[model samples]
Structures are given as C-alpha cells and as structure tokens.
Target chain A: MLNIKNLHVKLEDEDKQILKGVDLTVPAGEVHAIMGPNGSGKSTLSYVLSGRDGYEVTEGEASLYDHDLLDMEPEERAAAGLFLAFQYPVEIPGVGNLTFLRTAVNAQRKARGEDELSSGEFLKVVREKAKTLQIDADMLKRPVNVGFSGGEKKRNEILQMAMLEPKMCILDETDSGLDVDAMRLVAEGVNALRSPERSFLVITHYQRLLDHIKPDVVHIMSNGRIIKTGGPELALEVEKNGYGDLLAEVG
Target chain B: MADTAVLASKAPVAEKPRSVLDARLEALDLPRGGFTAAARADAADRLNAMGLPGKRDEYWRYTDPAAFNAPTAEPLAFTSRASTLFDEIEQLKLVFVDGRFDADASDALDGEGLEISTLAAADAAGDHWAADLYGKLETAGQNPVKRPFAVLNTLAATDGVLIRVTGKVSRPVHILYRREAQDADVTIHHVIRLEEGSELTLLETGGIAARSNVAIEVEVNKEARFHHIASKRADDAKVGIGHVFARVGEGALFKSFTLSVNGSMMRNEGVIEIVGDDAVAHIAAAVLGDGTEGRFHHDDTVFITHAAERCESRQVFKKVLKNGADGIFQGKILVKPGAQKTDGYQISQGLLLDEGSQFLAKPELEIYADDVKCSHGSTTGALDETAMFYLRSRGVPKEQAVVLLVLSFLADALEEIEDDRLRDDILTRLDEWLTSRASA
Candidate 1:
C-alpha cells in the first residue's frame, strides 16, 4: 500500500539532514513497526509523507499505489487515502469538533468526487463510531481538542482515522502520552479498523504498544536508516536488551 | 444662531495653525430656524474650542483626521452595491439619500409607543421632546477625550432622525443610508430617548456619502433597554466618521455592534456611561479590511465608564486585515469611586493575513473602586500555522481552511451580538466576503 526508496530529507531552515537515504515499504493489509531512538528521523518520515512545511526532500521518491505522494498537496494526499495520527494533536479553539469533522469528511468526499453525506447521515455514522471510542456528546460539541486530556486527544485522532477509513495509516508515537488504559483503548480502536484492504505503519518506541496491536514485521532504525528487520520477537529483544546491542551489531 | 466669527472668538487658542480649522468652518453653514438652534450654537462653540484634530492629538494618533479636517470631500464614484442585511426582518424603514431624508421612500412615522420625525420637520415644529437630548450626550461624552469631528457633526448636521420610545417597541427602526452624489460631504445627528421600562432596537445599514460624519446620542432611562446594530459597506474611496454617545440609567441595558467592510478610511468611536446601579453596557465591532480596496485604514475607539455600584461593561473588537491594510483599536474601561462590584471586560484582537498588514491596539483599564473586577487584553497575530496544517491534512482545501480560521478568529466579537438572526446575517456576509476574496 505504501513504498519508499532511498528517501532523503533535511530541515528547510537549517543545515540539518533529518532522514538520510532511508528505505522501507509496507504491503497491503500488513502492519509494520519501526522503532528507533530519539531524533532518529522516525517522526520526520511521517511529516514528509504528510506534506508538512519546512521539510525539503533532497532525494528519492515515495508513492501510494501509482500516485506520486510527494507531488500531491496534504489535502490531496489525504483524499488519496493516507492518514497520519499526530503525536501531539493541535488544539484549535473556536472551531467545534463536530463542525471540523464534518468539514473534513465532506472535503475529502468532494475531492474524491463522491456524494457528500447529509447532516443526519453524518450524525448517525459519527454517533456509532464515537460510541466505540467512548467519546461523548460534550467531546463532539466542544472546540476541537481544546481542554481535552492526552488520552482524549489520542482517541479523537483514532476516531478521525476510523472516520476517514484511509488505505494507509501512519501512527507517529500515538502511545507517547497515553496511559495503560488509554493505550489499550486506542489500540483497540486501531485494531477495529484493520481490514484486508487497510495497512498500518506504526512507529513506536516501546514493545508495550506493539503487544496490543501486534505487527507482522518489526524494523530497527538507527540514525537515519533502518538497520534490521525481523519478526515480532525482535520487539521483545529490543525491549530486553535495548538499542545498544542492535546498533553495535549493525556497526 | 451664533456666527462663525463670534464662535471662533469664544474658542480656546488653536493648537495648530488656525488657517486649517478656519477654512473648514468657513465652508459650512449651520441650519437656521430649528429647535436645535441653541444646542447647535453650543456645539459650534465647543468645536471651535477643540479645533480640527491634528495627527499629534492623543486620540487621533493612530488614525489621521486629515480627511475629516478637509473643507470639502474629494469627489468619488458612487458605488451601486446595495446591502440586503435586514430585509428579511419585519421593521419600519427610513431611507436617506446623500444625508437628506427621503419622505416619499420612507414608511409613515407612526407606530405604537414610537414617535419618529425627521430633524428638519421637527426643527420646523419649533419645539419637541428631543430638544433636551439634542447634543446633550455628545457634550457629556467630550470629557477625557475631545472629539472635534463629533462636535462638528452636531453643529453643522443638515438632517437626521429623532426617535422617542415610551413603551416596548414591537418592531425595529431600520435606517438605510444610500449614496447618490460623488462629492457629497454629509453630516447627520440622531437623538434617541427610551423611557423607563421601554425597549427598542435600531438598525442602520449602507454607506452615507463620499465623506460623512454621523453621530447618535442615546438616553436610556431606568430599567430600559437599547440595542443598536450598524453595518457600513461603502466604496473603497469613501471616508467616514461615526460616533455613538449613550447614557444608561439604573438597571438599564445598552448594547451596540458594528460590522464594517471595504472602506478607504473609517473611524468609529463609542462612549458609554453607566450612571445607575446594576446597569449593563456592551460595545463591539468586527472589521474586515483589504488594502486592495484603496489604502484601507479602519479604527475603532471605545470608552466605557462605570459610575454606579455593580455596573457591568464589556468591549470586544476584532479585525481581519490583509494586503497591507491597517487596523487600530483603542479601548478603555473606567470604574469610578464607590462603584463597588463593577465588572468590566475588554478584549481586542487582530488577525493579519500577510506580513505587510499591521494591527495596532491600546487597551486601558482605570479603576478607582477597591472591590471591582476589571480585565483587558489585546493581541495581534497571524493565523495559527499548526492549526492550519491540521485542517489541511484533514482534507480541507487551503482557501477553505483560511476562511474557517478567519471566521473563528472573529467569533468572539460576533458573539457580542445578542440576536441570533442578526448575528447569523452578519456571519453570512462575512463568509461571502472572505470567500470572494479567496477566489480572487
């Protein structure tokens, strides 16, 4: 569902290279996990894929199916069935949560040339989805992410992911601020969306989150490139021995 | 009526060269044979005392008063854009073209608990109830800050409407000002008096003229309520100055909101005095300025005083500027001695769409009461980048995302409008302006 070949990225404002000739790919309906040390360019890959500003791609290409992902705008990337669950969800005041979701949903639908959902239809679908995520009416009525707890923000992000039904999903440290129960809840929400046509690239720093949403393949990233790829047991090995032995073995 | 020379002799020494003020005054003639004759003469004396505002003047520092100081308005092409803001609401309509009341186009000035008359007709009657209120509130509002243009408006105003409400008015009084003259230099003064236990809503829309000075004096008695909503949408080359002076009595409510769009130079000043206990006053404005519309510069200046115990006052102003447009806000809230438990709040914010645009704000709070709650805040910023990316990543187009963020930035000022329908109407128009600009 997603492919990257020798991607290189650097900061736009500074002379700092974030991602150096990294290469990885995730097939359809598969879950792949990439674990790395801090400042190892895990988050940079997600940002560059989502078409955020202040990032310059110096080399390589990435694509979803036949479409060149780097050439599309963020909204176009989204309309092409790509979703990124942010690590720190932005708090936008004065914009109602329901209004934002409705706008986003209709926007993508319009971009894809699909019939827009009516208000009543949208309410019904959102009500059903929010119930599973344990988001109440107040959460939907308030301003987007403003005053929400960390767990609530993560759940809101996953709820958005569920509503969009993207073909390729990237979770960038979604487990960073969540507690045990919140993590379980978020993992269950993500797991519920796993289908034969959907794929996930889960980026986490711990095996604890992987325990909830098991990955088919685990990759160890050091510096800017992935150095090792193995089964789920690799996550346990990293949890026990840490990246010290893995980085030394690669070196 | 007093002659210009006699009034000038009684005036204070001109702060600047007297040539400018003298030439401006020499070009205008005060209305004769009116009940407002004595009041107009007093105002003329006051105007001569203050003279025309200079750039160095304290209140005029942010906004240049050169346009108002000119002897005649620079000729402008009349715009044909008509406002359909309050057409859906049932109301009494009054139409004025080039500052002259149109008797044929206006509805009959007859309504239950309402007495409305043109200033010219009322002045011809020799005497009226508004005689006591004529220019009284404007004179009271001159303290702490001298508004020479408002004084001049009261002195040389050629026509306006006089309204007095004795009981609860069932419908709003809608005043529509239309411009048909290119070189129309217009002055209008309105007097409104609401008796005890009465309520009224006044709606004003459209542009007055190429250059206009408009003032409204409101006297709300005990337990009365007054709501004023005005929208100014003039051509890009227009220059206008508007002032509202209100005195709210015990247990009364006074609220005023304005929406201004697409003006070259516009200044709006509001002075509200709450003299009775438990009175409430609110003044708010939303400005949409685009410098592409000919050197856009808009200013909002508000001063509210709490003189009685437990009085409340609020000031909310928001501006959205783009393409080098300039927006200025100067607001002050003062709580007098013995006005215990007074609650005053003021917030002014500006959103600059580009780096070239600028927002200047001055928020002040003066409190003499020991037990009072007062807060003031002012902010100038661009749209939030993180929020923008979040919306765009969620699939909203860039232009649509900008409109959403701009509307969200203005929601606070729009909330000050109590009527849901009126607020919705203003929101609709604002959205249209933003959408059209985005497409362009």
Candidate 2:
C-alpha cells in the first residue's frame, strides 16, 4: 500500500544529502520493521513522508495507494490516509486535545465529503477510544501535550493515529522514551488497529519493541540507504550480534 | 425639554472649564447650595489640586493623560424620551448624552427586593448609600494617575442608572450608554449595587457615535454575584475613553469582560478590588484596532485578598493590531498583606499582523504574602509559522489559515465569558471588524 523508490533528499540551504537513494515498499496486511543506528536517516524518512517543511526532495517519488503523497501538504496527506506518529509531537498551548482532535477529524471528513460528527457523538467516540487506550478524560480536556509526561505524550500520538485510522502508518521511534509497561500498551494498541488492508512501518533503533509487534520483514539501514533485508529471524540475529559486525560486512 | 435646552445653550459655561482639573469639576453639576454642595466643592478642589498626571507617573508612563485634552460637549437637554441601540434587550434603558441623563427615556424599578431609579432621584429620596458609595471606590487620592475621569464622573455625572437587587433576581439588567455626537466632551458615571445573595448579569454596550470621557462604577455586596460584559463598536471619527471601578464584597463573585472593535482613539481603564474574604474576580478583555490613526489602550488593575483570605482573581487580555494602529495592555495583580492562600493569574498576549502594527504588553504581580500563588506572563509575536504551514499544506488558503490562528489566539480570552449569546455576539463583531480592517 506504500512505496518509496530511490528517494533522495537534502537540506534546503546546504547541498548536503540526508536521504541518499533510499527505497522501501510495504504491502497490505503486513508490518515492516526498519532497524537502524543513530543518524541513519530513519527519522528523516518519516519527516519527508509526513510532508514536513525544511527538506527538499531531490530525487525519486513516494506514493500512497496510487496517489502522489509527496505533493500533498501535511494535513492533506493526513486526510489521504497517511499518518506519522512523530518522535516529538508539537505542544500546542491553549488548544485542548479534544478540540484539536475533533477539528482534525472533521477536516478530514470534510475533505472526504462525509457528514461531520456531532459534539455528543464525537465525545462518546473519544471517551470510548480514550478508555481503551487507558488515557484519562482529564488529559483529553487539557492543552495538547502541555505538561504531559513522556509516556503520556507518546500514547497521545498513538491515540491520534488510531483516531485518524490512516491507510499507511509510520511509527518513528515510537518506543524511544516509553517504559516496559507503556511499550506493551502501545504495542497492543497498534496490534488492535492492524487489518488486512492497512500497513505499518515501525522504525526503531532497538529490538525490544519488535518482540511485541512481530514484523514480517526486517530491513537494516546505514548511511541513508537500506543495505539489507531479511525475514523476522534477522531481527533476532541482529539483537544477538549487534550492528558493529553488520557495518563491517556492508563495508 | 426646557432643562435640556438650557443645558445645551449654556455652551460658554461648559467651555470655561478648559484645564483638565477645571474640566472634571465643572463636568458635574453639583448642588448650588446645601451640605452636599459644599462636600462636592471640597472634592472638586481636591481633584483640582492633584492636576493632570504627567509622564513621570509610573502608571501613566505608557499612556499620557496630558495628550487627551478634556472634552467640551454641551450637556444633554432634559428629554424624557430617547432611542436605544439594541431593541432585543427589554429592560429599562437610561440614556446619557454628554454626561446628562435623559429622565424621559429611563424607567424606575419600584418592586419588592429591587430598587432601580436615577441617581438624582435616589439622592433626592434621602438615600445615603448613593452619596457614600458614589466616589468611594474611585478615590482620587488613592489612584492619582487614572482617577481624573473618575473624579470628573463623580462630580459632573448628573443622573445614572441605580440598580439595587435585594434578593435573587432572575432577569438580566441592560444599561445602554449612547453617545449622540462627537462634537463635544461627555462623561458618564453609572453605579450598580447588588445586595447580599443577589445575582445579576449586566450588559453594557457603547453606542455608534464617539464618546469622550466615560466612567462607570459598580459595587457588589457580600454573597452577591455579578457578570458585566461591556462592548465598544465606535466609528473611526470618534474618540472614546472609559473607566470601570468595581468593589467586590466578601464571598461575592464579579466577572468583567470588555471587547473593543473599532475606534479612532480608545482607552479603557479597569480596576477591580476584592475587599471581602473568599471573594472572586475575573477580568478579561479583547481589543482590536486598525487604520492609520486608530489607537487603543487598556490598563487593567486587580487587587485581591485585601482583607479577605483565600480570594481568587484572574485577568487575561488579548489585542490585535493592524495597519499603523497601536494597542497597549498593562495588567497588575496585587495580593495584600495578611491575604493568605491567594490565587491570582494574569496573562496578556498580542498579535501584530502588519509591519506598522505595534503592541506593548506589561503584566506584573505584587505579592506581600509568601504563601500565595501568583504568576503573570506576556507574549507579543506574529502567528506561528509551523501551524500556518501545517494548515496551508492541508489545502487551506493562507488567509483562512491566518484567520484560524488568530481566532485560536483569542479563544482563551473568549472562553472566559459565560454567556453564550454575548460571546457569540462579540465573536461575530470581531470577525466583521477583522475582515473590514484587512480589506482596508
């Protein structure tokens, strides 16, 4: 459902390339895990796919279900069923989480020419979803990510992805700051949202998160390029042997 | 009719008080002969001795009172009939033009547990409360910088709406102060009193014409609750100045919201004092100014926990400046000694949409007690670029994105208003003002 062909990107001011000819593809009904070391362009891939500014796409194309995702704005991409669970979500003060969520949902619905949800119906759905995610109603009433704990903010981002229910989900370092319990809860939430027509790309540096959400494919990335691909067993092998041996082999 | 004509024809008598000090005392038509006359004369002499505040005054530094020369509008004639701005409000309306009350257009409340009459009529009925509380909250000696308008309002204001709610009243009170023309100076003093356990919602809106030098005073007793929402939508040719003084008693709750849309030069000075323990006061304001010469200034001061413990106070202000207009917001929260456990918060934020637009926000907190939680924050900047880009990338136009961000910036202040109707009305007015200003 998601495809990236020889994607190359660079900083706008400097000609220094960040994503050098990276290629990836994830079909429906499967989760693909991209494990990389620090500064391997995993987060940069997420930002480019999510249409964040300050990065120029120098080469290749990214498409979501036959649509040109690279040309769409961040919000348009969101409406087009592309969701990116950011490593660091923006904190919007004075804007309540519930209000922000509703606005985003309604905006997407309006783009799709669907009827808008009433306040009562929206509140009911949000309450149920929040309960399922173990998020308090008071948290939903507060300013978005303002004064929220690290785990709480990550969970809030996951909650948004669930609400948006995108066709392609990109989890960039979703397990960075989460504890064992929080990681388990987050994995469970992601697992529950999996479907035959939906796909996910879980990008992380550690293999601990891979134990909860089993991936069908594992890819190793270094120096802004994907160097190797293997089955789920490859994740276990890397966990035991580490990336140092693999870096020498790639060289 | 004869009274109004006589006052209108006596223009030379009004023009004699040119200086700020003389202008204030002469604005009020004090009694010619009586004990009250001598007392008013003494008060006027005291006001004259104080003189107009200069730039050296700390509080008046940002706003120079010397620049605003005293207005010289002829006193309104005695007309029992006058028009109103909004007809949907059914309550009795008191009309004051150039600081003179129109007895014909006003109504008196004479029912049980309720007293609604003119200040002149109430004083004639030997109501000592009227005289004692008239200028008590706005003592010239105490607040020397911003009391010139208050002093003028006290001494010159002939007739005003006197509302005394003894018991719980269900209906809302609407006081409409309509400025007829911008030819001369005018000052109005409106006093409201709510007895113990009384509840009221007062709506005050300025008229279409420009009004110079207007002041209103409100006092709430113990256990009383009041919600005052004042809106100003004046024309560009008019210059307006207003001051609101509120003294909240013990256990009483008072909330004041002021919204200003368009004016040539406008200033609103707000002072809310919490005297009784456990009293609460919430002051919120939104001011919008545009055009080359349009300027708006707001000075809000709130004193909580004066003698009462555990008092709570909040003040929030938002301003939008465009074109060459200027907006100023100065808010201070004071927690007096012995006022323990006081909770106070003050925030002032402004959005400057153009290069020539200017905003000055000063938020301060003075606490004498160590066991209190008081904080003040001020921010003045353009719209958030990331939020704007995010919205624009979603197919939203740039203009629409700006409108959304501006509205979001003002949402916090607007949410403090409890009445939905008033809130919606003010939002609509703001939207219109923004659109027109942008187009211009």
Candidate 3:
C-alpha cells in the first residue's frame, strides 16, 4: 500500500510549489493513473516521490507499507520495493545491461538480507523475463542503453522493472516516443507483471497507454493538485473532450 | 703454499665494483670501424656534456631521476638466471640481464624464416641493416629538452635481441629483460628489425625487481607490420626507468600497447617515428598507481609523416591515481610540412580517486602540413556524480560503483588493444587490483 498526505514539494531555492498539498492513497491490487497537461507538475510529483535530490519536500508524509518513504535514500527506497521507470534513461557505456541488472537486483537482495543469485541463475531469470519484453539476449549483453533506439530503451526499462519485481512501481511517460507495436509490447510487459499484492502509478499526458493497462482509478491533476477522481470512463472523456474542459473545472 | 697461491689467482673475486656509473663505462668493448660503436661513443660524449638531468630540467620536472641513484644494478653483465615471468609465455624467449645478452638462458635460433640472435651477431653476419637502422629514429643529440636516460641507454647498451621476421612469423617473439640485484647500475639497448613484407608480434615484459635503468630501440622496415606489447611489473621498493624508441618505415604499420602496474618510481618514454608514406602508428598506455608513496610517469612523443603522405598516428593514455600517488601523461604529435592529408589524434584522461592524488595531462600537437586533420585533447576529472547516484540507486554499494565507473573510464584504452587474450588478462589483473584496493 502507498499513502501520501498533504504532500507539498518545491524546487530547491524557489517559492513556486510543484506538489501543493496533494493527497493520494493506493491500496494493493490496484493501478492508478495520473493525467495532466504539460507544465502541470506531473513529472515533478514522480521525482518528489522517488526522493531524487534537489526536490525539497516542504510538508508532507509519504509511506510505503507503513514505512516512512521520505527518510529513505534512493537506493534504500529501491530496495524497499519502490521503483521509478525513468522517462529518459541514462546511457552508461562499457557497462553491460545484464551486468547492471544483476548488480541492481543482487544489491536489493543483499539489502533485504537475501542470498545473492549466481551468474547462471541470474542469466536464466533475466532471459525468461526478456522474452516477454521482446528484448534479444544480445541486447542485454551490450552496454547499458548504448546504441539502443528510443523504443528499445523504454522496453529495457520495463525489463529492468520486471527483473527487479518491485512491490510498488511508477511508470513515468512509459508510452512516449513509442510506435504502436512498441507500445503494445511494452504494455504487454507491464500487464504481465500485474498482481494482487502489487500497485502501480501510471503517469502520462495521453490516454492511449491507459487503453492497454486499464487503471482502477483515474485522477485529473492540474496546478499541482488532484481536482477530479473518477472511474475508468474519465480517461475516455478526457481523450475525447481534451483537458480544456477539465481546466475550467479545476480552476 | 704454491697451490694456494695458484688457486687465489684463479678464483673469481667479486670486488665491489666502483660506482655503477663508472662500471658501465668500463664494461663497453668497443669494436673498431663499426658505425654502431661510433654512434655509442658520440652518445656517450653527448651524455658527458649534458650530465644527468636534474629536477630543474623541463622534461624531467615531474619525474626526478636523481632519487634513483642507488648502486644496485650493474650494467652489461650476462648471467644464467632468467626471469620467472618468461616461463609462462610459450614463444621464442630472449633473456637480457643487466643490459647484456644472457645466451645461456635463451633458446637457440632455429625457427624457419625467423632470425633470432643478438645485435652483435647480426652485424657480424653482414647484417648491415642492423647498424643502419639502430639510431635512425632515436633523439640523438637533437631535442633541446634532451632525455639523458635515452642518451645513457644509447651509450651503454652492449647487446640486445635482434629479431628479424624474414617472412610471416605466426608465433610471437617474447623479449624478457630481467635485471638481477647487484650493487651497480644497468643500462640496456635493444633493436628489433622486421624485413619488408614481414609481419610479427613481439611481447616485451620487463622483470626488473632491483633498482635499474633500461632503454630499447626498435625499427620496422617498409611494408612490414609489427605489434609490440610491453608490460612492466617491477618491485615496489625499487626505482625503474625505461625508454623505447621505434622507427616505422613507409607503408609500414606499428602498434604498441604498454601496461605499467607496480613500481616505486617508474617512467616509460616512447618515441615513434613514421618515416614512410601511408604508414600507420598506434600507441596506447595504461598505468595504475597505488599506495601512498608510488609514483608513475609516462612521456610519449610521436613524429608522423616525415616524408610521407596520408599517414595516420594515434595515441591514448589512461591512468588511475589512488591514495597519495601521482600519475603524469605527456603526449606530443608532430606532423611535417610535406606530409599532406596526415591524420593524427591524441587523448589523455585520468581519474583521481583520493584527495591527495594528482594527475597531470599535457597533449601537444605541432603541425606544419596544411591539409592535415590533427587534434589533441586532455581531460582530468573525478567520477561522475550522476552515474554514481544512478548506480547507488540500483543498490550497488558505493565502492563497487566506483570500481565500475573506473573500469568504464579505462575500457576505451583496453578495448583498443587488438589481442583479445592479452587484453582480457590485463583487464583481469586490473579488476583484481581494484577490488583489493576497494576492500583495503
């Protein structure tokens, strides 16, 4: 379960609030979608929740599984079952993708006091998960995100999330820069990881991604606060009517 | 009483030789009417005039050779003892101890199309090519900022391995320079000649645990290809100084990769001259300085397109300075006037892991040709903060993340090596060293 109460965040050394007294809660076994227009602080909220540096949390309480999330470091949060699928993944040369994945997974395992996986066992699990994401074995052998296409990088992120198997996941614009086929494959990979004990926060500007991984709840965010909460039908309404009408309601 | 007197006269009395500097001069058996001997005399005279390079010298500013004045390595003494490192290499091994040829420890020259013998033997067998190409590429009495060590090597070197690849020698030739412990100084001069249209790979490993000085000269002929890989793993308590001079002829290709890992104070100077048109030269170096007192320095100068057109030269240097150690890289590329369409690129990069660690990188490009594409760049920086954060976010410990980043920084130089097995071996050794240091 994930909970946020009156979450207030602002850029360091700036007075402009990005997440203004926001409140949200996601019980296990549900997917939540946050939709907003450009400059609505959608990405800022994700970064604030992930505890990236330079985003000062002015006032708020965030908890994952009854543990204070704001007190944890980035790595500690990751090991605590919090995963953020980056919108723009970093390119790391000379570090193989599989090696990076194994290092991350084993690091989380070590932090959780679990035994480390052997090379053979890690490879076996990675190959099996990569099959669903349609990532070739050679791609994993190459350097992390080096020479990977836009869609391939997105898919690789999903592959990592699947490999990590985090309890709570945040997909940040996972559908951006993806063609129809790539979007379908990525959505399928996300859909395959869905379970009753896990939760996801899907952030996007378009409603197309929601068509594949239908969310149990849809929240319309504007001016750094959620103004509307409805069922899945709200997504279709926004796709057809656009945010212009929603802006009026929020204002 | 008469028998005792006779035995006393015949016994090998090991008198503590005079100053290593003086003993080196006395060991030379100069031959008459020989161009090599005349060159040696000229170099010795020039060395006497210039004297030893002090800390004030511009070239020796960063690396002071005066601290290495210990009288432990004597020059020009042939011994039966060979280096243990050569036992692992399966090739034609030539052992040189104290700047002289150790024939007893070396194998006989019986390979087909491969003339593996001493430089003196080659000259005696009417091999005029050996003498003609000896000092062709070295900085002899020229270079305003002269390297006294090179001058010393030229004057004091007695005999070294002279390998001629008449045809394509499939197996590599290993040259092992093993320095024994004695209360004296040592200087060595080596020459390698590859005939026209011949190709060979030469692996040179310096196993000098004692305080010693060494120099090597190599020459490659027209259309000949040579790959030279040199590794230095000297003792941590001793000082090791070495200089390598190479001449690559027209239409020839020469590639060199050097790895300097352990030494108290080590300096390797490499000079490459591309004399012929369409010639290619590549030089790569990786030095690792650890411990609080270790110091390593590398100075490489390359002269490209002396009289040739469309020649290519590349130089890359990577160093990791840890603890309170220091690493320096000085690379210069020279393109002559008539050498049009010359291509040259040089890059030097270093990573300093500690606050007390220091790295100095200077890349200079001097060009006279109008239609040349030459560029040189040097970068000195700490580890990437974003990358470090990303790795840490993935649950990798800080130390392991640093190791990965350091390896990534050095991967370019290691990947430039063409030999897969040698490259892998070097990488493995580097990884082991890094892991140990990380734990420490």
TM-score of each: 0.93, 0.78, 0.83
- By lDDT rank, best first, the candidates go 1, 3, 2
Best by DockQ: 1
Model 3, B233-286: lDDT tens per residue? 533344667777777888998888887764667777777777788998888887
Q: List lDDT for all candidates, in order.
A: 0.90, 0.72, 0.75
Q: Candidate 2 versus the native: TM-score?
A: 0.78
DockQ of 1: 0.72
Could you tell me how far off, in angstroms, the CA of residue B27 lies in candidate 3 after the best superposition? 13
Winner of 2 and 3 under DockQ: 3
Task: Compose the digit string of candidate 1's lDDT tens values, residues B1-440.
Answer: 34346436745545363568888888987687378999888987777666777787778899988888889999878667776888898899999999999999889998999999999889888889999998899988988788888888888888899999999996899999888888999999999999999999999999889999999999999999999999887344799999999999999999999988878899999999999999999999888888986889999999998999998899999999998999999999988899999999999999999998999999988989899999999899988888888898889889989988988888878888888888888888888778777854
Worst 10 residues of 1 chain A by lDDT: A91-100
Clashes of each: 0, 12, 4
Candidate with better lDDT, 1 vs 3? 1
List each candidate's DockQ score: 0.72, 0.21, 0.47
Question: What does each candidate score in C-alpha RMSD?
Answer: 3.2, 7.2, 8.8
Provide the lDDT at B284 for model 3: 85
Between candidates 1 and 2, the one scoring higher on TM-score is: 1
Q: TM-score of the candidate numbered 3?
A: 0.83
lDDT of 1 by residue, A1-251 (tens): 89999999999999899989888889999999999899899999999999999899999999998879999999999999999999999987767899889999999999999999999999999999999999999999988899999999999999999888899999999999999999999999999999989999999999999999999999888788988999999999999999999999999
